[model samples]
Target: MAEGGIVRVRHCGAAIFCRRAPARCPACGSPLRGAGLPAAPVRLPGPFRHGHRQPRALLLRPAAGTFLGGYDGRSDLHVGVSSSQGVVYNYDEEGVHRAETGWEQCISIPLVQPDMFGLLQQWDKLLEEFSAGEDWLPHRYDEHDHNCYTYALAFVNSVLTAQGKQQMSKSEFTERFVIPRTKQASRYLTLHQELTAKDFYIVPLPDGENQG
Candidate 1:
């Protein structure tokens, strides 16, 4: 199992990850099952570490101010991909940029486990060639219909094709991968804000919220 990774439990349809695992399921209070009884939860890395350490990752950052700067309690994000060299490739109003800086404030979602796709050596080259393609031209950028998310998704699909895997549509990818991770980020942000503003944060739950 990956260190501090997320776990999905089918027994109670619970997806929970934390620093320490409780003896019983936090949701249903059942004995934790699986190879790792106390499976570690994902610990979201600080931006500085994530940018320098996580290569071949899908990265997200607040589109405007810092994540905590959100007034409406939601994040509007910009998406990018990390090259094998740890440089970030993202599309925006200025077109695709190969960036070494400015990614120190992003979240990382791994595109694959280390060396899983057998393309680590060619990752940077592929990103460069793809970003230079006419489809991602600066003039073609659009905020809503075609934007950073589209650019990142396109690159991901290109890699999937090369890996001989079925390519995912935007909706499919967003629903399965992006949504779950983003939801986790949102929860983290909310709790952080609450704790920062007070001695402790008490999350008010709906009745039976933890019943599973």
Candidate 2:
């Protein structure tokens, strides 16, 4: 596993690789590493990471799994709740199948921290938007992208309402999750974007937001 519990896809030559396994290269019977090939700034995810957005921009990230959901304090203030429609149900056969009967799920994860501040920022350079300077210093970068998919927020009110702790209100809900007016220069720098936040969060996830 990685230093943290972050597990991501790796590429070796023309093949994709994974760090933990039983997983083998589809082309060869070898283990994988996230750093298997080249690591480029363009390879890095997020323009926000490139100093794009104004600071105080809090982002949200969602936590998603195949069959279950749980709380993760290791993440930002927001918690995300999501469900997937299995690819097995789609008849087009265009989706890649991990197994014969199992369908790949496209899960929607939300982040309530700020721009480029969650797991989705860990995007493939060939697959994602580019940012400069992440490579100019040669410091090791967090593989996790400052994005929403991995840094999803579950919303303080969303969880409470679902758990019967906080009553649901349209006004209260909207006020809590929408974008805020604050520091406009330092949002979405790395993992745990919430840690640097000094203001109240307007997390969008229903069960998202609470300072630890």
Candidate 3:
């Protein structure tokens, strides 16, 4: 898989998108390996979904009505953690809630490998306890500072602490893990917007750019 949580496979001399690095391209059944990162955005199959059946993942999605689906980094987002059973634990104005729906609308960053059985066991329990804690009371939900992002980071730090690892601040985690994926998504959205508007979008390059 390439960086930014996307797998780019060369198919018919063009790149196609997948989240996992499959042995064969999902679109054409061709062997997929060492295709390298894509130079342009390609349409993914269906909507951009993640977190379903992905255990110990940090889930992210644009909040309702966000322009360009919040991949532009200028809008608010809803965040959550996924459990072994694909349930999402998140906080909002209504406080902590375990959700069985909405994973199909998210993009995920895996926080732990699935083979870590001991840690996976602890993850669900810790998530439950953290969600029920008093710091996440509905009355305390602050849109700008103490909302979903805060709650998600706190839970991630709790997991780090449990594993005797250094805990991460919100900015650290976001920069190190989240922003890359969002930037990839933003590129796709920008291309999609251009295609929707004009049916074709050409890259604007300086003189002699990429002329080999």
Most lDDT-accurate candidate: 3
Global lDDT scores for all candidate models: 0.69, 0.26, 0.69
Compose the digit string of candidate 2's lDDT tens values, residues 1-212. Answer: 11122122333333122222324444445553443332111121222121112112222222233111222424333212221211111111122111222212212223224453332343222111222223211232223433222222212233344345755454454365443311111132222233233211122222332111
Query: Quick one: ranking by lDDT, best first?
Result: 3, 1, 2
What's each prediction's TM-score?
0.71, 0.17, 0.71
lDDT of 1 by residue, 120-177 (tens): 7778888899999999999999989889999999999998898888999999999988
Superposition error at 167 for model 1 (Å): 1.0
Candidate 3 matches the true fold with a TM-score of 0.71
Q: lDDT of candidate 3?
A: 0.69
Question: Candidate 3 residues 1-212, lDDT tens each?
Answer: 11244434454444444454456654456565554443333435322455667778888877664333334556667888888788988899998888887666566788888677888778888888889899999999999889998999998898888889999977899899998878766776665554445523345344544221
Better of 1 and 2 by TM-score: 1
